[model samples]
Target: MCEAVEKDLYAVLGASPSDSVQQLKYRYQKLALECHPDRLGDVCDSEAESGRRKFLEIDAAWKILSQELQQAWPIDSIVSLEDMTWDHDECVYTYCCRCGGQFIFSEEELPWRQGNDDEKKRNESQHMVVCCDTCSLSIYVKLSFV
Candidate 1:
């Protein structure tokens, strides 16, 4: 996977990582309104472009930060791949969530599922973060290809 250069989303919105979601939302809204392209009326072309770019960055930052915040609840559990139930029909491994939802992992989604035996050995002890499909709860799953 190609990783894009990561910008500090918190810094982009003049926020600290410790800020509450509400605070982040407030900061994002304030910055977004101030730099919105349409709000930057009658500015020179360069200034307009800069405003647009800033607005885009702020918008992107909010999107990522909001999702992370929503999923930031304490991890419900730490489970190993062997603890999950496998469904041959669906080709997925599932673990029941406290909310009656399920945390699903597919074979294709496993990094160690690909590559050579050496690569798989290196990834024998890997981790995957999965969220409950119907709730905010998440779990850390220890993965093994053995």
Candidate 2:
């Protein structure tokens, strides 16, 4: 049995986070064709198994990327604090995004946000973290409620 794990699906598909939906689909298709086991009619059994695994990974990545869409408290780029890599400089908290963009959440934007950590945790939380200005990718920062 195969269990799904949390992974950087974009990396699996050889795609950047900001790639358009069309671009992502294209990449998935290309990888899918390349990795298809049938493409290797005379390969060894092990190689065929490897190709099947590769195809599954590519297909799953596309499914995840296509489902989600979304942004900020002056976050400059929309994203969640948790999904980001934290960096503290002076009074600012900088979050390094997955798409290689930075979302700046300063103390100034704190007031605009909901509440404290406890309250935020008890309730649901989502933030649109922007990936990069060059492309249209946003990090979906979501905390699921239990």
Candidate 3:
């Protein structure tokens, strides 16, 4: 796993995070429509590569922010207790992966609070806390099953 990209959601869509979900959706839709690979004309090798990369990033950003999507287990899938490890020194529960992101908590912090109903209803919403060791970017994923 890679670290969280830490992209400002606003910057990704060229709109503010405070923007309504409708606004974000519209912005993403417009970018996707305008930048579709099919619309890019034949071009030099470098230019084509750049266009392809941008299109892929845009599609990924949209998927990350889209209302219809939900978080799945990380590839390699942490499905059981044995899959996780405790970092006694850090006092955090860290996953073994390329990114090294940890669930920052003491035993006191166990049973992290889940998101509220409204947050779930609004797909634009996110969990309150998480961080990426790779980018030092904070994010929230709906966690479950270990």
Candidate 4:
């Protein structure tokens, strides 16, 4: 797809920035089915070229939209301390937001919460659960106590 066309991926998918992922997916699927090359049923039809082109554009829009959705909402990924992704990185812990978002718990927060020192310093910390800012969902995370 051309760079100019890429800029309006949301518009191409019939989506607005405010639309939820589910809404965007639904719209994209509907448009995709409508423009699918095979949906024309006749390869020799005069509009076949146009329909094929439309399908390509729709497919490209979906690909771009899907990637954005995934990044914005990583969801509940259960990462362990051993993953090495979090090693000395800065943040204390990370957790999923019910709204398909993620929030990080900082190292600065560990000392402020009331907890058993031994538990905090052990191989694992208690599961600290919190609600998602975007929705009425809960997020759970554990600190690497070891």
RMSD of each: 13.0, 15.4, 14.3, 15.6
Best by TM-score: 1
Candidate 4 lDDT at 121 equals: 43
Error of 4 at 91 (Å): 38
Query: Can you give the lDDT of residue 29 in candidate 2?
Result: 71
lDDT of 2 by residue, 1-146 (tens): 99977889899989896564445665787788889878878989899899899899898888877776322112243344555454555565555555575544444333224334576434543333333443344444433333
Tens-digit lDDT string for candidate 1 (6-116):
899999999997565545766887898889998988999999999999999999999999887766855899999899999999999899998999988777556544334
Where in model 3 is the C-alpha error above 4 Å?
1-5, 67-146
Alpha carbon deviation, residue 12, candidate 2 (Å): 0.4
Segments of candidate 1 deviating more than 4 angstroms: 1-71, 113-125
Predicted structure 2, TM vs. truth: 0.45
Error of 2 at 9 (Å): 0.3
Candidate 4 per-residue C-alpha lDDT over 62-139 given as tens digits, one digit per residue, 9 for 90 to 100: 888777665664345444434423426675454555457545544434432323456434444344433344654433
Clashes of 3: 0
* Ranking of candidates on lDDT, top first: 1, 4, 2, 3
What is the TM-score of each predicted model, taking all chains together? 0.49, 0.45, 0.41, 0.48
lDDT of 4 at 142: 49
Model 1 TM: 0.49
The predicted structure with the larger lDDT, 1 or 3, is 1
Q: Can you write out model 3's per-residue Cα lDDT over 23-131, one digit (the tens) per residue? A: 4555776787767778788878787788788777777777776543223222223223334466788765554344575433333232222223454434543222333
Clash counts per candidate, in order, are: 0, 6, 0, 0
Which wins on TM-score, candidate 2 or candidate 3? 2
